[model samples]
Target: MKQKDTGVMLLFVTTLTVIIWLWAAGQTKTEATVTTTVRFKAPEGMTSTVTPSFASVTLTLAGPRSAVNTAKAACANGLDLTVAETDGTVSINDIASRLNALDELKTSGATTVSAEPSAFNVDIQTMVQVEAAVEAVLSNVTVSGDVTVNPATVTLSIPKRIRATLPDAITVQAVVSDSALQQLSPGVVHTRDAAIRLPIPLDVPDVTVSPSRVEVTFKIQSMKEETVIPQVRIILAGPPEDYASYTVELPRKTISNVTVEGDIDIIDGIKSGEYAVFAVIRLASRDMEQLISSKPVTSFLAIGKDGAGHQLDVSVENPDALNVELNIAPVSGAE
Candidate 1:
């Protein structure tokens, strides 16, 4: 009799165990389907590309609260976003790999599926395609019509961290420009790069640069230095018997350094016209290079602090060519 009772009890316990197992299985949630998204930007100077605007990013997300936070890490480095100009084409395969690769979101035993557009729509813009070539200009650099781009302009953002070999000095050999740097009045003008207004292309394909476009600034001293310059004098014996005075051209003028160091006597005597001082050079005609050449000059030291000839040590500077002449003037009473 006890044996029969024991069998009955064992059967009852078995039935209870089956019921409990079924209940636990029902309580466990099946892998769920969730949606998310990703975003990225296209590089500039890109004429075109074969990328989609939107993607149906279905992510197989599963977690026990722990893996839920893992979503943040999923896209950290695993998912790479590709950008395009148009809302072209996308496919399940296009993102399945990335979403599937997020092993962290996968359930231990069950499977999950990612819904379309796992996130939101991405934004893209027209990039201005550019091919950069650094050209050196001394007189003035110009963005001439030679260069062309679809956008015509770009936003040049120099990276704060970019490092490159910056040229110590840019030489502008006295040139005349009509575009911007035309102020050759012998006065100084700190030059500013018109490029400042133009953007510097960055993120070039194979080029690496730091401060790709730097501002070329220069402070021009006065047309002439403040120091006493050698002046030329023009002496003429006679013009034609009929002419009173003749005009001539002494292209180059005498220029002196502000730092003058020489014998006290020679320096002092320079102001007295003792060492063949020439103050008034005559550039009577039109000649450019001829005017720039340094030659001998003849004249008096007529230069003074107040134009009255000051007393100080002065020397012949740039004693190149001097201009002097005799011209005929009509008498007041007679023609």
Candidate 2:
């Protein structure tokens, strides 16, 4: 009797297992998500404020078999979130786009509103090592003394080594000519002659200081009263470079109110004749049918003033002489 009971129980268990397996055969389980992403905007301007700087965001997904499979490829493409656009001037649209793209990748589970990229932060405080160019003007400033530079405007790029030491804001040491040191203004005139100082922030690289410091040449400007050489003249009118028999002269001594505008330094130039009279020559075209047709020769100082108070390239020994092989257009005899 006991054996019969045991056999019957085993047959009942077998029947239950077969029934359960048969009922569940064809249905497919819903698919689950793999990943998800969070995207932020790329801000514009100064870049001082933009953070984290993430490019593509990822997301994990789960859903119906087809939807979950689709999520795999979509998530790979990444989410689009855009940085808010306030003013038309900024380039933060990338961020704005990325932020919006996240949703398309995977459906936000009805259970959770957030997407992937669990936690993120943008650090604006990472001591941005940057290089700044400082433009200094020597406007009314003058050299302290007799020093001179080839170009008044010093072009300098801060070296990476030195730039590494500079602060957010940079201040260059004052520049004063050694010769004119005594004549400088009561206060410190730290910068002069369009002198430029590069801001060498801490830990920068691959830069150079132009001229090291400005070249202190002999002299370029003066601070004395402006003086005019009453009889000194500029004689630069003659023939073109091709003309050999061109003769230029200021038959009458050349004198104009010597206008020294900058400072006494320029006045000194007037007295020294280092900056002497510049002569200009102009030839009007014989074709005066209209001022528009033949433009008058522009006023150019073909000859710069020299030390001897005369036109360029001419000396007292040689006098004013040039060979100008030129022919003026003959006057019109047309009807």
Candidate 3:
């Protein structure tokens, strides 16, 4: 019986010591250091700007061990502050009090002792929603006609300060991806969804557009081919009065090996002479007057119309060299 009683007494003493230690540990004063993120937001019809945009703050909290642990856990998730004032600075001194006042910290009996980052600047501006036109931007393809964008206009939520600096009219771009353009088939309407983007200088934060994606519709032409036309005839043309007053002479009546590129059918027509490729030197009264100085005059060549009086769609190669040398003098028996 004595041995059993001693064993029970020893177990009781050990259990009491552990309970006391646990209670003391729970009530012990402690300090915890933690790093947390800080975010700021504005009310409706308002926009806010922070200097760093993203902020991480370190804080030292003081309280009982349990309370400090609770505060530390809350700090890990960071804090969000609402800006009521239109513009002001957020000082570090203000952050500690705000942290202590947080419900998690307050209820847990934790106090913020200190914080890193002595200060941060914040500015708030009013926001206005305005309608802006959206344009489709395409590349690596030739559009047959005007590109159509569905919901041609979108609402833009722009800050008042930014709006003040912008022009009365605003346009956003719906840029089509290059991959989509490459996959487009020729001679058919292709519909695609492109994300809208603000023009340069306006592509900043706090500017958002409703219906971020717009449908763009366009038709593209087939891949083009290049061909050369040999010995295209060059002609001299002028106003009647200028022609009557001056005799114009051409040094070269034909250009050789003129390269042109366009649709395959158009290229074939040009090569087979079904469509004529010619250059014309046009002279005005001013040109005739300049010729009187007896100096050789240079004139740029203009592409001639086809038999149907329609301009050809082919692009001339080395356009800068498509010129003629003109020699002019007074017509015989004329002043």
Candidate 4:
């Protein structure tokens, strides 16, 4: 009786297994088709002159349940379409081959995997990295002081293929807003990192700029004024080697009148004697004692006082030259 019971049990178990298998087969047949969208990208080093119309492809996958599941899982991360050739257009066959080659998709038992629109055209271009200059756009502001820029240029990753041809020069303009210009008052200085923007060409779509911004610095001074200082003494810059035996004299006791023109604030400071403004004649070291007699030499005015470390833009408006006499006799054999 025990042996008979065991045989019956075995038969029951086998019949149940066959029933489950049939049910699973029916389910697979009922839901064997799965469509998924896979994102495709162009190969590296290949860029688009014009953006691609489609960034993704709809793939209809149909096969056994197991295959569909595998394909779905594999495609969940999307597809990378790398082409050895850069013809701007990808064919359906090429895509199919790539999808079939994927181990996950291949093993998934998908009978067919196809893309919608099969193929499409893209204006393709090659990319090149180059260093480009940064130009400052200063409009509606008068620059009376010094202007400086840090990192006056930037590196650009640009596309340079026909339909994607690079211009002879690639430059980005850094604009100084009107608001910024409004802040330029006398003695006012401004420093800031201004963003650089690339002007879109007639048809170019994109450009990549590294260090897209740079530090721009400038000092703004009030409008200049002309001030005349009379009887300003003229001093020789470097004296002759035989100074003890030589004498120098300006035929004119002093500049009849030295006219300086610059920012009012700076000019006032100079006039107040807060800064030392001098008329000087710079002589070449080699010609120190060579002057046998008095000679006229051009003199320029320079500031000795540190006027906020700014070079005074003052110039002598009158008497562009000053004549001076150098009386020199070499001290006994000392040339």
Best by lDDT: 3
Q: Stretches of candidate 3 above 4 Å error?
A: 1-24, 43-45, 87-94, 122-127, 138-146, 177-179, 204-210, 221-235, 239-245, 249-329
Writing each residue's lDDT as its tens digit, candidate 4 over 11-46 gives 999999999897687448323334445444556555
**Which one wins by lDDT: 2 or 3?**
3
Give the worst 10-residue stretch by lDDT in candidate 1: 166-175
Q: Candidate 3: what lDDT? A: 0.72
- Which lDDT tens digits does candidate 1 get at residues 253-286? 2344422323344445554655443344333332
Estimate the Cα RMSD of every predicted model relative to the unseen true structure: 15.6, 18.5, 6.4, 13.7
TM-score of each: 0.28, 0.24, 0.66, 0.52
lDDT of each: 0.38, 0.39, 0.72, 0.61
Q: What C-alpha lDDT, on a 0 to 100 scale, does residue 318 get in candidate 2?
A: 20
**How big is the RMSD of model 2?**
18.5
Candidate ranking (lDDT, best to worst) = 3, 4, 2, 1
Give lDDT tens digits, candidate 2, residues 9-121. 99999999887675454223354444444444444443232244454433333444444555565556555444533322333423323333456543532122234444444
Give the count of colliding residue pairs in each prediction: 35, 75, 0, 4
Residues 1-335, candidate 3: write the lDDT tens digits. Answer: 99999999999999999999998997899998989987766655555554445578888889889888988888777777555646545443477776677677788778888878745666556678889999898854568987899989999988777789889999999999888777778889889999998987678877888999999998987645566666667766668876777888776777676665555555566666576665555666887888842222223222324444223333345554465667888888886
**Pairs in clash, predicted candidate 4:** 67-108, 161-164, 294-325, 294-326
Best by TM-score: 3
Could you tell me which 10 consecutive residues in candidate 3 have the lowest summed lDDT?
Answer: 293-302
What order do you get sorting by TM-score, best first?
3, 4, 1, 2
